[model samples]
Target: MPDKQFAPGCGLVGTVKLLDIGVPTTNLGAVRCGEARAYAFWARNAVAPAAYQILGSELAKIESMGSYSCRNTVGTSGPVRLSGHATANAIDIGGFVLKDGRRITVLNDWASADPALRQFWDVIRRSACRRFGTVLTPDYNAAHRNHLHLEDDKAGFCR
Candidate 1:
């Protein structure tokens, strides 16, 4: 399992500890209830088709960079500004695992030569924008070059 923790803060007051989306997760990471709901929604509505069309397989799991990191928007070294992550309201998606035992990662596949892979990302990106309050992709900045940052704050900031 990937590293995970439950240190909560940023107006949350320790109310959230685990990101139980009501499904078994591989890395055992945590997420805010809203983020989990959005992820579940897009996984079923978008990831399934993207997986089938690109790899002719079913999506087995959605990979993430993690959630609930208490930090600033720029990262650990930056000034503290209470990112959505600080409240477990954000999730960083890095890849997807297919039932065929294939892993499609954003770091390598986001700009791959395969049209299917690119198309798959496009579909997911658009879908995320619909569900998340803030959808930051590589297009947003260098910080998001390797994953899609999904946050639900009802802020209506999607990119």
Candidate 2:
């Protein structure tokens, strides 16, 4: 989809395409992101592979809060700045669904008692960090206690 210009210095910089991230999403249906970057390739090659490696079952769908928000960065106390979402270059992952109908949510599974569950989250986070420029998990702060913020901004900040 074409980028919509909201105002001066505030809008997507490139075509916003629906990413076929190799897995469907529960809420997002189609992962819409900037086409100027390799976010889709990273999701399909890096993120999906890592997830399938540990899931042991067929991965069904990803769960996302949404993307492409026209807003500033949250959880920061300094001067406000446009967020990756402003340009559709970021995605917020909230959870996952297995083919067997099992669901894993970051809010509940990130600190799950099951070792395997914890390991799954760890592996996914690490894998995303390898591709996305900025990966923020529940461990980053309270604001992210329910989702993993993945951005392709070349910031290289992961937590």
Candidate 3:
């Protein structure tokens, strides 16, 4: 299931779809065309290139919290602006599943004791900053303590 229409009143303005990028995921995560491309590009240019050096294996799946929802930003109460998720313009990557059968989650490994994991995490974050306009990590706030929020809003925010 690549593309689907959001239910009426989902706060989306156009067509949205889950990306099928030839990689396995724990579940389907919806994203816009640009986001999909960014993910693919990151996988190809960042993850794969450093997989062996960091994880001693090939890159596998990217575990994500998925995308597309009619909701406000996390930690916000009422009357908040719609987040990129509301329009399928963002992705929340929770972890990376390596081909060596190692699962590295952001919540668990962002500050791992192992030097390789820490380095890998930072590298991915910086790489994401280069590609996405808004890249929020756990350091940004407690609300983002469990995932790397990548959005292509071109707002020039990378924290």
Q: Whose lDDT is greatest here? A: 3
Which residue pairs in candidate 1 collide? none
Q: Counting only residues 3 or more apart in sequence or on different chains, how many pairs clash (N, Cα, C under 3 Å) in candidate 1?
A: 0
Model 3 scores what on Cα lDDT? 0.79
Error of 3 at 51 (Å): 2.0
Per-residue lDDT of model 3, residues 1-159, tens digit only? 344555543544443454455665555455677877887788778877677687788878888797778777887667867788887888888988888899889899887899898889888889999999999999999999999999988888998
lDDT of each prediction vs. the true structure? 0.74, 0.73, 0.79
Models sorted by TM-score, best on top: 2, 3, 1
TM per candidate comes to 0.80, 0.86, 0.85
CA error at residue 151 for candidate 2, angstroms? 0.3
- Show where candidate 3 strays beyond 4 Å: 1-22, 76-79
Superior by TM-score: candidate 1 or candidate 2: 2
User: Of models 1 and 3, which has the larger lDDT?
Assistant: 3
Q: Say which prediction, candidate 1 or candidate 2, comes out ahead on lDDT.
A: 1
* Model 1 Cα lDDT, one tens digit per residue, 8-127: 444343333444443323542556666777777777777777788767998878787877678778643555677887877888888888889988887878888897788888888988
| Candidate 2 Cα lDDT to native | 0.73
